[model samples]
Target: MNCYTLIKQKILAVITQLQSNGGLPADLKVDAITVEPPKSRDHGEMSTNVAMVLAKAVGQPPRVLAELFLTHIQEFDEVRTADIAGAGFINMRLHPSFWYAHLSTILKEKEAYGSSDIGQGHAMNVEYVSVNPTGPMHAGHGRVAIVGDAMAALMEKGGYDVTREYYINDGGAQAETLARSAYLRYLEALGQDIGEIPSGLYPGDYLKAVGESIAKNYGDAFKDQTEEEYLPFFETYAIDAMMDLIRDDLDLIGIQHDVFTSETAIVNEGAVEDVMDMLEEKGLIYTGVLDVPKGIEVDDWAAEPQLLFRSTQFGDDVDRVLKRTNGEWTYFAKDIAYHFDKFERGFDYQINVWGADHAGYIKRMLAAVKALSDDTVTLDIKTCQMVNLMQGGEPLKMSKRSGTFVTLRDVVEAVGKDVIRFVMLMRRNDAMLDFDFDKVKEQSKDNPVFYVQYAHARVYSVLRQAEAQIGQIDEVQLQNADFTCLNSDDEIGLIQVLASWPRCIEGAVIHREPHRIGGYLYELAGAFHALWNQGKEDTTLRFIVDDTKVTLARLALLKAVATIIASGLNLFGVEPLKEMR
Candidate 1:
C-alpha cells in the first residue's frame, strides 16, 4: 500500500482506540483527518492535524488530544514514532520497513503503480482548440492542444471516461468569407491573372494550394457560373481542406480528438430549432435588446430589440442575444444548441478548454447550460493563458491574419513531441507560460523534461551494468533480498519519494490540475540524482556489488523510483527515455 493509505488507516485506528478508551465519543467521524508529508523534511515522514480539527468538539486542548491519540497510534507497524508538534500537529515517522515493503508492490504493479480510482468512472467531455476555421492554427493554438491532451490523459488515469472533442465552427459569416476566399483562389488556379488578395480576405499560401487542387478537380467548367451556383461547392471544399490541414497539425503534436462536432450540422439537421423550442417551452428565451458591452463603443450599435436568452438569472453579467434584429441567429444561439446536444447525448460533465481571450464568454456559456438543463449538467471551462515564446531571450512574433503565424508543426519539428508535451504542463493551465525555445531544447538539468527522462535512463544504465556484473537479477530473487541494507540518507530519500506517488496523483486529479505531476517528477529526479552522486563518492553505494543482498536491495529501490517516473511521464504524455546520449 502507498504511504498515504497506510497513514490514513493508522489514524483511523488511533481514533477508534481513543473512543474505546473513554477519551472521545464512539460515533465521531474521522474522515476529515488527513496524513500528509510535512512542509519541511525535518518535521517527519507524515503529519496529521486530527487533534486541531476535533479539539473544540471533544472539549479538550489540542495538545492534550494529540498526546491522547499518540499513545494509541504508536502501536501500528507503519508508524515508528508519533509526537505532538506545535499547536497540535502530530508528526509521525514510519519504520524503514514501511518504505521497503512498497518495493514489491511497485515491481508487481509496474505501469499501474500510480493509477487511482478517484474518479470512479465519471464521464467527462473535454472540448479544446475550437479555433475558427478561417486560417491555419497559430502558436497559441499549439499550447492549448498540448495542455488539453495532457489533461485528458491525467483524468483518464484517475479513472474518468474522458472524451476529447473539437467543436468545428464551420458556420456563420466566417463560412461565407472562407467561400469567397476559395472562389478567388479557384479563379487564380485557372491561370487567370488575379490581383493581390483584398485587404479583408485571407492572404496565406495555404489557400493557394487549395486553389490548385480545385483547378485540377473541376478545371474550367464552372468559370461562367455565378457565385450563387459555386458558393455551396466552395464552402464544402474549403471546410474539408481546412480540416485536413488541421488534422495534420494535430498529428504533429500527438493530439487526437474522439469527436469533431460541426455547428453547421446542428442547423442542417434542424437541431437548432428543436433546441430553441425546448428553451421557449421553459420561458428562458425571449425577444429583447442587449445593452452595449462594457469598456467598448461601436458606432453602428443598434438600439433595436432582438431575441435574447435570460442568462442573468443563472449568474451571467447580463442577458445574451440569440438573434439579431435582421432575424439571423447569433453565434450564441448555435453554441447553446451545441451544448444541448451534448447533454442529450448523455455526457455527465462537459469541460471546455478555451484560450485566455475567451474568458469573458465563459459566464454566459455556463449560464446557458444551467438554464437549458436545470443545472443537471455541469460545464467547466478552463482557459489557458498566453504562452509567450522566446528563443535566446528574444520574443517570437505571430499573427494569423497577416500570414505571419507559426504552425504547430514547426514547434514539434524543432523540439520533439516529448519535450513539447512535458514543458507545457510544467505550470498550471491558468498561469502564463514563457516557453523558452532555448531552455526546453537544452540538454542540461534545468530542462525538467530531460531531467526526468534522464533519471529513468540512469536507472536503466545501472540495471544494464548490474546484469553484466551478476549475469541476471530477477525480481523474484530481489523480492527475498534483505532490505535492511538500505541505510544511506540518499537511499532513504528516494524511498520516500516513491511512496508518495499515489498521493501526488490523488491531489492532481482532485484539483483537475496536471502541473503537480510535473513538479513531483522534478523532485523524483532530484532524489535519483542525489543517490547517483552518492554512488560517485562511495563506490560501494553503486547498485551492483558481487551479488551482495544489500546491493540487490538497492537495485530494488532503484526499480521502484524508475517505475514511478515512467507512470508520471505517461500521464503527461512525455516519453520516458531508456538511455540519454
Candidate 2:
C-alpha cells in the first residue's frame, strides 16, 4: 500500500465521521485535501493541509479545524503522534506497527506491491526516437530511446494501456539527399570514379554498404541514368537500408516500438488534406500574411498571404503557417494530421518525446492538439536535453555532418546496453547529462547502477545462506515471521523507506519523470546497504543472528527489500541480479 495514500484515506475517514456527527457540513467538498511527507523529515513522516483547505468552506478558523483533526487523528491505530503545525498543517509520525504491516504487504504482494488500480487500463500513446532515415543513429539518439521506452514501461506498471510508436521521417528533403549520397557510392561500386563526397549531402561511411547492395541487385542500370530517372528508386533503396541499421541500433537497447507510422504513408492516404478541411470548417484556418521573424533581414523577406492556423488563439506566440506560398503543406500540417489520426484511434492521452532544440515548438503543437481534438485528449511533450559523451575527464568529439559522431553501436559495444540505459536515466530529461565512461564502470557506491545491483546481490547471497543455515523459508513462513522482533531504529528506518516505494511510483507517474525511479532505487539501495553495514559494525544488530526467531524476522525483511528492488528494475527493463560480477 502507498503510505501517503493510506494516510489520506485515514484522514478522509475521520472527516466522514465528523460530518456524520454534524461537526462538518455534509456537502463540503474535500477534493483539495492532501497527505504527503513533510518537506523536512523532522516535522513528521507525513503531513496534510486538510484543515486549511476546508477552513473557508466550513466557516471556521483553520487552527480550530486543525484542533478537531488533531484529536481524531491521534486515535488512529497507525498514528503514533499527530500535531498541529503552522497554518493548521497536520504532521504525523506513524507507529512502528504500521511500517511492519507495510513490510509484510511488500513480501505478500511481491511485484504487485507498488502497482495501483487508478488507471483502469486507460489508453496512452508514447512517440519517441523518430530519427530520420538518412543515416545510422548517433550517440545522442540513445537518450530519447531509453527515456521513451522507460517511460512507457513505467506507465505499464501503473496499469496504462500504452502504445510505443515510431514515426518514420522519410518524406523530407533529407531523404532526397540520402538518395544522392547513395547514388555516388553506387557509381564507385560500379567501377566509376566518384571521388570527393559532395557538400550538403550525407558523408557517413555507412552509406557505402547500401550502395553496394543496390549495385548487386540493379548492376549498371542506375550508373548511366540521370538524377531524375534514378532518384526515386535510390531514395527507396537508401531509406530501407538506413531503417535496417536504425532497427539494429534500437535492438542494442532492447527497444521495439508497437507501431512504426510512416510520414509518406500518412501523406499518401490524404490525411493531411482531410485534417485541413476539418480545421477550415471549424474556422481555425485562414489565409493571412505574417510578419518577418525578428532575426530575418528585410532584403531576404517574402511577404504574402499564406494559409495559416489560428494557433495564437490557443496560446501560441503567433499564428502558424499551414501551407507555404507555393501551396506545399508544411511539416506542421502533416503533424496535425498525424496526431488527429492517433486521437481517432481512441488513445486517451498522447506523449511526444522531443529534443531540447524543440522546446519552442511545444506551444504550437499543443495548440494544434487542443484545436483538433477539441480538448478531448491530453498531449504532453517531454523535452530531453543532450547527452555529452565523456572519457578521461574530457568531451568526446562527435559531429554528424563530418560523419565522425559516435554511433549508438559504438557506445553499446563499449559499455553493455544495461549500462547505457541506466546512465541515460541518471539525470532529468531537461538537464544536460554527461556520460563519463570511467565513472559508470566503477564497482563502487559512486556508480549508481553497480550499487543497486550489488545490494540485490547482497540480499540474494544472504537468502541462499539462510536457506542452508536455517530451513526452507517459503512465502507462508515469511508472512508468519515475528515482525515484532523488528523494533530497532535502523530496522524500522529501513522499513520506512520501503514503505515509500508506492508513493514514489505515484509521484513518478504524475510528474511524467521516470528519472524519479532512478533516484528512488538509489535511495532504497543506500538504505539496505546502511543496515547491512550496521550489522557488520554491531554484532547484536546483525541480520542473521543465533536466535532463530530474530534471524527469521531479519531474513523476511531482506526478502521484502529484494522484492522491491526487483520490481523497480523489472519496470526499467533491466534484469535483477542474483550475484554481482
Best-performing candidate as measured by TM-score: 2
> Compared with the true structure, what per-residue lDDT tens digits does model 1 show for residues 63-141?
9988877887787777888888999998988888888777667877887977888878888888898888876777689
Write down the lDDT that model 1 would get: 0.84
Worst 10 residues of 2 by lDDT: 396-405
Tens digits of per-residue lDDT for model 2, 1-581:
78888889989998898899999998888898999879877898889999999999999999999999999889988889989999899999988888889998998899899996556799999999998998878777889888999989888877789999999988878889999999999988888898788889888889989889989998998877999999999998899899999999999899999999999899999999999999999999999999998999998988989999999989999999998777878989999999999999998699999888889889999999999999988998998898889997899777454386888888888888888888898789999999888888999999998999899999989999988888778888888899999998778878888899998998888888899988989999999999999878789888888998999899999999999989888777777899987
Candidate 1 TM-score versus the reference: 0.94
At residue 90, candidate 1 shows an lDDT of: 89
- TM-score versus the correct structure, for each prediction: 0.94, 0.96
After superposing candidate 1, which stretches have Cα over 4 Å from the reference? 13-32, 298-301, 397-402
Worst 10 residues of 1 by lDDT: 397-406
Winner by lDDT: 2
- Give the Cα RMSD of candidate 1: 2.3
